[model samples]
Target chain A: MNLALVTSRDTDQAVRVASPLAVRGMTVSYGQTPAIFSVDMTVRAGAMTAVVGPNGAGKSTLLKAALGVIAPLAGSVTVFGQPMAAMRDRIAYVPQRTSVDWDFPVRVIDVVMMGMYRKLGLLGRVRGQHKALAQDCLDRVGMADFAHRQIGQLSGGQQQRVFLARALAQEADIYVLDEPFAGVDAATEKAIIAVLQGLRDAGKTVLAVHHDLATVPDYFDDVVLLNTQVVAAGPVAEAFTEANLQAAYGGRLTTARVDPESVAG
Target chain B: MGAEFVALSLPPILIGVLVAVACALPGNFLLLRGQALIGDAISHVVLPGIVVAFLLTGLVATGPMLLGAAGAAVIAVVAIEAVRRLGKIEAGAAMGVIFTAMFAGGVLLLEQSDTSSVHLDVEHALYGNLESLIWLDATGWGSLLDPVALAGLPVELPRMALALLVIAVFVGLFWRPLALSTFDEGFARGLGIRTAPLGLALVIMSAIAAVAAFDAVGSIIVIAMFICPPAAARMMTNRLGHQVAWSVVFAVLAAVSGYVLAGYGPLWIGAQASVSAAGMIATVSGIILGLAAVAGPHRTRNG
Candidate 1:
């Protein structure tokens, strides 16, 4: 039985690739307070998965630990069946809009070009082809005209779109975004969702720390309900039930009512 | 200006210009990262580094000074981080406590050591003896180009230039990574660009620039040059490339004009001796920053 189990594990590694992101027993802390505890999850390939949780729910911390931005207290994350460090360029991150000072001296084009840094590496010359790609990404986000404009010139929604455009320029196989929908306009919300869906349809993994439960059923194929830990994780139909939402939201989300039939259909 | 006057003042002006350029490039990044205080902190902290190096080597030269400066820079960063992490103090408070302590330690070391026998002086460390640093044996312009004559030139000038060149190469080679990491550290880390090393590069560069130019410009003037030109450039331009270019231009202008005014302005007012050129250079940089803050393109456009 032991030999059979070992053979099965070997087959799992050799015959099939690991999911884009697999988190096991992950824990993170801020100072003395624990933010996330033993959170286990897997971001399946070629799907849009929303990580839903309340405020201070360790949503951002989970992503930060996974990317090795903040050192995790415990556990590990594997990307594309390898360590994150081994497969880094294949994943891109979009930090929250508020994390950066918009008034920093950089144009829209400059911000987008930053996403190309992974490909350019250190000291690589930014060629005409790179500029063309940045322009194309800007156009995709309806920010082509504002390429020359400074980041401060763009409004909040426009800023979020600009960020999305930069992520597009990265062309990573997996995208991780933090609070992309916060304080965004309706049109920007639609644009962001469309871009995410486009990424999903192109066989890319997109995991976002999303809050708007109203649009969860419409937007995501899978969901990871989190509340300092993984409450439930799987397809939208089986996992994103009212029970999981309640558990993740800790009964604070009084109005959450997901119809299982529609999710299944 | 008279030929004698021009020849006498040229070295100090060149020295000031090089110092400003070196400080401004690193300053731009520091300002962007909101770590402007780090430049201020580094200048003060480098003094003790210089003293400790002097004590260790019993000789003062480019090599020992650079070593001391780099050591002090590392100590300051580590101390600040340690205090912030272990003691749970905020970064600013930690910086304030450590830099002042380091500066005091250097002063104490200088007082305790047999530094009197050396050419290095406390007064020179505070306000550089710009007039005394001239290449005393030079004949004329021809002397400058002559390789043998160039060798006789004061050790400070070449050291400053080499330091500026080092700063240029450091900034030029790592411009993209530095910008990305500074602007969005989390995103940069996600892209697999280790932000820690990039941050370490900035600290080391600041220390090098501070130590290299400190002998000529003094630590206070180093502080001024590190902040003023970049702050002015930032006010003027909304683009990072333009900000860096404009900072260089502003540095050169402040250096040249400040020296000219310091030496010749006394004559304009019918006085005899000129004021300290290093002081004037720093003052001019400040004036330029103030003007930019009020009338810069960013302000008017935003308005």
Candidate 2:
């Protein structure tokens, strides 16, 4: 680890408790309506954590607040015990594919290159080396051949892969994803899980807002069940029980069941 | 045609090309962001800005006009934001109301003032006084190099050219940030790109383009050039780089061809007098846009 790049305070905090993400008494509201309130969660460093919740469960909101995308009505979040701003270069964010205008006239390579925009902004030109790095990222996600295709021409799984490739291009210490597995095929889901597991092996943290519950224990080492608050958060086997799932999903047992009516994980 | 006739026609034609290119360059970003009417809104809104500046300074200098125009651009955006919030109106309606009200107020102010003595008037605000700009005091190209002749150049042409250069530099320098911000604002923000300053720069660039084109192309053509060339270019290509290139090509084509046709089309029909060049340029850009909208590769007819 490059101690020179990180603040001393952050290093001390990481040594005390190695956690990439920490949300203490966090609250977020939208126009007088509280979306997520009084939530506290700390994701273990170098682990894959799945944030599982029903729709509007503030699962995505939690990630947004952690990244400073949405202002928290209360509480604070830190990355490796430092403010997100100070450690921004170490965080890679992958927003939901639906949030992007897929119909925008751009090639897949252009979207991947956006991850490198921060490094090349206005001053450095996009050289062949940058393109090679972007291509390598794309190849990792198994979409290298589709680099020249227009964004609007991709399937749901392909679009998701492109976004992951973008985050890969960031070369960050941690990745935060929103709804990555939504509507993707089983093969894409496996591929994504493999890539995330590889990152975990490399001592990098990945926090994803996941909807599929059946594979939580199989795909993740940690779990945070949330519904306007942290219903439960710990090791996946410990926190992902049926009772905690019920608490997060309210009385709706049908959708709360593990992966409800899908192929077995 | 005689060399004398060619020299007489040179300045206006060049002016049209410069103004069209200047307006169209920034227009590509506006088109991509789905803010095509912002140019029109700026052109109309800046009328009051120019009028108030002229009213206060009692002179038609670029300095006061530019200051007033920039101020109005800021006010116009602020007013639009207020209307959208207060009236609970959508952005389109809010923009429409503010620009039209300010334009009407400008016309009223012009009518009430002693602008009759000045070259500026309400009628000229719509169609422009481009036909009257003649820079051929000397005979040929050699005399054009003379310092007196150089200094005596029409201010409108030079102003439009400088605006073009500024637009080129701005887009070139900020291409990455601007493209990222426009395409995905949230993603840009997450990348720690401060999008607000870039957005403000975009609005300021539009204001500058509007102010520069106002004296030469008028409010109507300023708007037409802004929306039409970019929209046509968008239809012609799916890549942003190609869109910008095709937009410049379309703009130059429209400018030169429109000027030539406006000044010479009637002579082909046995009529003696020419039509308004500004109107022709606007019309030609519209026709190009209409053609692209109907026939361009980007059209969506079927799967």
The model with the greatest DockQ is: 1
Off by over 4 Å in 2: A1-17, A253-265, B1-7, B82-90, B111-120, B301-303
**Model 1 lDDT per residue over B1-303, tens place:** 444543576777788888889999999998888777777788788888888889898888868887887788889988977887888876678888999999888888988889988877666776776666776556676666778867767788988899889989999989988998888888888888778878878877887888788777787678887889998998888988899999999999998998888878888999999988888888899999999989888754431
Error of 1 at A42 (Å): 1.2
lDDT of 2 by residue, B82-165 (tens): 897788877678889999999898889888988888887766778887777777664667656788876766788788888889
lDDT of 2 at A112: 96
TM-score of each: 0.93, 0.91
**C-alpha RMSD values across all candidates:** 2.7, 4.4
DockQ value for model 2:
0.46
- Model 1 compared with the native: what TM-score? 0.93
Q: Among all windows of ten consecutive residues in candidate 1 chain B, which has the lowest summed lDDT?
A: B1-10
lDDT of 2 at A230: 90
